[model samples]
Target: MNTTSKSKADTIAKLREKILLMQGFKPAGAMHKRITGLMPVEQAFPNQVFPLGAVHEMISEGPEGAAACGGFLGGLLGTLMADAGICLWISNSRSLFPPALELFGASPHRIIFADLQREKDVLWATEEALKCEGLAAVVTELNNITFAQSRRLQLVVEKSHVTAFIWRKDPVYLSNTTAVARWKIAPAPSISEPGLPGVGFPHWQVELLKVRNGIPGSWEVTWSEGRFHTHDETVRKLVSVRNDVQKTG
Candidate 1:
């Protein structure tokens, strides 16, 4: 490309980003507010801060993967909902017992679980939930989401200041969406803290595959103390960069 073409392309990108900031969407530079109890994730985001009030995603490939993802989110919600009080959990997975969430910090009473049968109903319910300012958070499980649907949720959450977590199970398929972040959660073997013979706190390989206006990450972490702790400090900032490198080299 010529210098003139390259310059024009750069200018357009800057203008687009500027418009997003003007309209109240988070910019990659200005960042956003940080949420409490996500200690290890703080280092993974830009400026050593995590973005709150944004939609996040978790994907898993199998039953074991889905369970691992749920475990991580349950632990996360415990910290996220401590001050907010009420939370709404929407999913078709009857297997997700409310009592299980108590194993984390969020009590079943504080959470309102909506068992929606159809995908459309789940999405509809989730969007309405996000519009409520009284709720601390809304969690939904689905197979996929379109860019348009995600944008609608994003706009609503921006106004309501409610955070949303969308869990897409059994699909490694990636699609474009307006979510602030996307993560892949899979179970990792745990090592007991007290050298006991039984299973310790849940462990997971949490991969921050995408973060809008921020960065991606790969973390082997354990859920303890009501939050996530780093299992390996060596690898970080994971995404397409590493994949592309492998393909070429």
Candidate 2:
């Protein structure tokens, strides 16, 4: 064979090897399917496949703020489901506002809100949500979570091929856990037209505090008109305080 032909064959062989490795590295018990495309994050930052078997920690400051974060994450998960799937929201503090969730593109009917009275119950329900294959994703609001509990939840999500979203009231140090990513969500000032008067409802600033296999940094995201989009520089600068908290805390 010619040298050029032999080199082409070698490249093809290497590509096949990489594909095989990816297939094997996928979390066990996950059923592989042909996903058509990913949801849109922004023109600059495209949406990515939701990592299976790994906990995705989304920390927000309060109940209202957590709901905003949960809504965005939940909508992303909802877009991935082939059919309308159950979205389990496990919380001990407050029930999510349906109207606010609608702003994030989540259908109220697809969501199941479970209000627990204690932390133990919240964790137990979160585990159950992770185990349920019928669910597309599970969003949990809690004050505290231990590494051991996170590990258990991760295993369940892997086995069930479900996404687990933990919305914490405050930031907590996580060590010895298999979380793929950790995010801090905060409210950002709304954008306004040059001639327009009066302030508008605020947007959100999403900072990826930690990502196992992706870029980690601040991304200004806003939920408006039933969609999530990246923010402009002015909006991002206005929300510098939230970014500072995520960076320093």
Candidate 3:
């Protein structure tokens, strides 16, 4: 290559690096990387992985599915809390027992749980909590969030650089949003421990239905040893592309 051509390429590379940093991406080798809660998931995006500083939507079709979603979120929270920051969890009502999170390395003391009964209150509280850059992450459970509402949440997260997790329970309908990714999780059969009579660890089928700047994929993930380990299930992925109450009952 000519000297002038090489110089142009270097200039372009530098500009891209600066743009990625402005977009909240961290330098990862010659490419930019986003700190998604899951490592395998981070790899799925290639150059544009899911970013924690954006809203992520999760939905399940039935009660069992909801259980799986909740289980996965627990592990997600564990990953984010490694930096020792406060996390806000806003929901219309409590579903899972607080003690269950102990296995995921998140002590109940580190979480601020708020019960917002009204739908409006839940949305308002979620938005407010996400705007606080001091918090590590914000999780909220709601029935519906339109595209406009989700865009608003995204704006706040972008400015504050905070992650937002939205759990939609028994949603009436599913639609696109400004979230970096949308997921659907269903409970898979538990893996039995060797030489034990009882079940070993909780497992779930995770389908990344939609990811704005990453690949969509599916995997069987299990929670054991305080972290998520994806089974060698031949990660089904693509380039681009809800629930009932009584989730665990």
Best by lDDT: 1
Question: Would you list the C-alpha lDDT of every candidate in the order shown?
Answer: 0.77, 0.66, 0.76
Candidate 1 local Cα displacement, residue 115, angstroms: 0.8
Query: Which ranking of candidates, highest TM-score first?
Result: 3, 1, 2
Tens-digit lDDT string for candidate 3 (1-249): 699999999999898778767766655653323333356766665354556677888888677887778778878877677668788999986686778776777766899999878989998998899888889789898869999999899888878888899988878988778887788888876665434567668888888888764689987777877677776533222101001112432
What is residue 10's positional error in candidate 3, in angstroms? 9.1
Question: For every candidate structure, what is the RMSD over all alpha carbons to the true structure, in angstroms?
Answer: 7.5, 6.8, 7.2
Q: Each prediction's TM-score against the native?
A: 0.77, 0.71, 0.80
Question: Once superposed on the true structure, which residue ranges of model 3 sit more than 4 Å away at CA?
Answer: 1-24, 29-37, 46-50, 233-249
- Descending-lDDT candidate ranking: 1, 3, 2
Pick the TM-score winner: 3
Position 78, candidate 1: lDDT: 77
lDDT of 1 by residue, 1-249 (tens): 699999999999888768756645564343243444466676765445555677988898788898888888887777678775788989877567678888777888899889988889999999999999888788898888888999999999888878899999976567899887898999976646433567777878889998765668877777777666675433233324444554897
Query: Candidate 2 overall Cα lDDT vs. reference?
Result: 0.66
Candidate 2: tens digits of C-alpha lDDT, residues 1-249: 699999999999777657634532343234532222222222112124445445778778766676657666755654544366678888888656666655555677778889889999999999987888888778888767888888888778767878788877765654545667787777666555444667655466777777654567776566555445566566556557545754897
